[model samples]
Target: MKKVSVIVPAYNAHDTLARCLGSLVNQTLQDIEIIVVNDASTDDTWEIMSRCEKQFPDKVIIIDGDRNRGAGGARNQALDLASGEYIGLVDSDDYVAPRMYELLYEKAKEGDYDIVDSGYYQEATDTARLYTGDDLTGILDDNKRKKTYCRRRISCYQSF
Candidate 1:
């Protein structure tokens, strides 16, 4: 089994943190270590995190920030604590399928790719659509392919 480090950066996310943690805890890939960077939330988020730590003592590690660090700062904290060969980043407000990591790990291994870029559904009531490989050379004439591929977007939600 492949070991994975699930890094989640949270800030005042009490409302959705539990749901996010729930999905992670229920993932089929059980050999995972969860690293949560609490970016100085002024809510009950830390309390919830403490409770989760108590529940999953061996699996959860909470890194509390003294001041408000942005998402990048928080993720950098997680990156420092991560120990797995494969790293996964998840937003505190977003939830994923239970088998998401398991399937992605398998796909990466089978494809023999150093990095695998997979598509995901919108999680709304919309019908599912398969994403076949397409030649998107002229799709966005914003920049050169070499540069675009070099500095690709890390998260689909954020341009950075």
Candidate 2:
């Protein structure tokens, strides 16, 4: 089985899909499976995914959405087909650092946590802001606020 399954939900995201998939394909963690769900995109998103499927025949899996299901539903479909020990979610418009999943998976295995969450960097045209768990107290809900805070303290890994 693959070490991790990364689910990507794409809508009318042709412009950003290539960059997103590029990040995943170049991840430092090679033992991963990428499941791309085309949520009935009106643009050329399906074509982009098809090309990626061909490029990474062993690592990429493409799923067609007959109707326009929102991101949540698309993710649910990929989740059903996931065959990895850990599941990772990445939006079609977003990309991660090369070592993000590698570091997170290492920590998860060491700690044996049921779930492992990482901090994120929100990027704009000129700047990017990093949000650690402590900074998420007010932003996340009460339940998530506590869990997010605790994970950062327990795990020593960091992501860009």
- For model 2, the run of ten residues with the poorest summed lDDT: 151-160
Which candidate wins on TM-score?
A: 2
For residues 1-160, could you state the per-residue lDDT of candidate 1 as single tens digits? 2277888889999898999888877889888878888999999989888888889976788989888889889989888888876788888887777788777667666755344444444555453333334443234445544544654433322101
User: Stretches of candidate 2 above 4 Å error?
Assistant: 125-160
Tell me, by lDDT, which candidate is best.
2
lDDT tens per residue, model 2, 57-112: 98999999999889889999999889888898888888888998998899778867
Alpha-carbon local distance difference test for all models: 0.72, 0.81
lDDT of 2: 0.81
Q: How does each model score on TM-score?
A: 0.78, 0.82
The TM-score obtained by model 2 is 0.82
